[model samples]
Target: MSKNNTKSEGAEEEQPKGKTCFVIMPISDAEGYEPGHFKRVYEYIIKPACTKAGFTPVRADDIKKTNVIVIDILQRLLNSDMAICDLSSRNPNVLYELGVRQAFDMPVSFIKDEVTERIFDIQGFRDIPYNSSLRIDEVNKAVEDISENLKETFKSKGDDINSVIELLGITKAKLPDKVEISAETDLILKSINALSSRLSSLETKNVSFAAPKVVTNAANDISITFNAVDSVGQVVKVSDRVKHFKKGMGTVASIVSVGREIIVSIEFDSGDTGKYTNPVASVIKVINSDN
Candidate 1:
């Protein structure tokens, strides 16, 4: 190759590809708290610091549709650069989503409402505390600290992945040859990553996840969510099988989250009713809720 070609190849190799970041937060908690706390903190404290540090903040509240929100949010969690989870108020949904993120082994930072107990058995994950009475400078200082910590985490992870790949004597060029469908799917993921990077660059911040694309043919929407822990002692692919329902004529497909556990939603068209006879899929996955 020519010198320019070699330089181009090196530049491409140095570029981190196939990743995005999803911020998982609880808009509500077990205490019936709404989105006020997060809104105030994000708008007043966290967001400006994120912008200053060049990080994109993706929150679940920014999503319009519930179904799309779930898909996009989860996808970003699984595939993104890093995840920031606010554990304030001990929200079940936040905890559940955090579990999913942990299962996928993504880099996540937890924040809490200062008074919430760390009762959950999620060991190792620590929460950053913020007092409501703190001055703006104090809050900004905390955010900057957290941002630095996250950046360090990303650096460490990169080193770790490189070490693992080297130990296994694996190279990106040696990855399994993806089939046509898989290639298309990879393209879809790559597009998301590229767009994510572009948006981050344009915003001069870290890219946050947008809502996911929900595919449904129903006049009135019905959503069923399937979430499972990777408890089967074996790696499971959420997209391993297409879940089908009787009389619905549609299949539930898992869009595997790259770094997190897989979650797939199955939506039935209006007026479609039939017994779902699929053999409970598998024990590796759980239905967090089918509503």
Candidate 2:
């Protein structure tokens, strides 16, 4: 009996821990979420916590089922062994899904930004909170708390699984078209296309934001000095003989002096209107203009 028990313990020790932890959170560039906050939580909070607990973390955007988005989400909500729902901003879509998950009375981890007000209905359930201020120390501690809470929840099955309907002795609602793979394809494709369009729009805006700056320079002035290191690594200042690296010839505008960093504001052959800053050690060099 003792030997059989020992063998069973060994088998259990070898068993895999954690599960495919489906993440339900607001995406960046979405309506409620601003540019950087959602990404910070995903990268620093949820993902690290999941990885620490040996779980595979994935968001709705990560799911690429060529089916219906609603159906695909439903399948994930129902089929996933674990879930972490971020209830920040009380997103209608998130709340609807949370309702679906709650009815199942399965292990669902709730979390929200520290600033977000607690949902009245989900007060019965536990929440592992994260701070949006994103102070490194605070975020790290929040990640630790979330990781520990998830581990505890994973082990304590049915301990604090809260479903309002369950408490009220009502039959739990069934998931939408449970595992109806055939009906999901069209919806999924449409969702993917829409997501692609949004992503493209964001990229265009980013490029527009980073465009270069043009400046006025004295046409005949050739007294500009650029600092560089020769083959022997000596400090060498090349003047009068340096042309634009790309344009073969260029004009130097006003050399604005600000602290230790020197910004070479110039107009190149290429017409653009954004100021680009590069490391002086790497970008600044004297090229032979006599050639």
Please give, for residues 1-291, the per-residue lDDT of candidate 2 as tens digits: 001132333343321165778888877555555687787788989999988877788788787754546767877887777788898877787888878877886667788887788888778777887777878998889889888777766655444435676667688776566444455876766778788777766665523222122222456432222322222211112232224444544334434434444345555446532222422322334444331
Candidate number achieving the greatest TM-score relative to the actual structure: 2
Could you give candidate 1's per-residue lDDT for residues 233-268 as a string of tens digits?
Answer: 222222232334333333343332323333444333
Each candidate: RMSD to true structure? 21.1, 11.7
RMSD of 1: 21.1
Q: List the residue pairs that clash in candidate 1.
A: 20-80, 20-81, 54-205, 54-206, 55-206, 56-206, 72-212, 78-259, 104-260, 228-286
Per-candidate TM-score against the hidden true structure = 0.45, 0.56
Model 1 segments beyond 4 Å from truth?
1-20, 29-35, 64-67, 158-291
> Candidate 1's error at 65, in angstroms?
6.2
Question: Which sections of candidate 2 miss by over 4 Å?
Answer: 1-18, 30-33, 174-291
**What 10-residue stretch in candidate 1 is worst by lDDT?**
227-236
lDDT score at residue 146, model 1, on the 0-100 scale:
63
Overall lDDT per candidate, in order of appearance: 0.50, 0.62
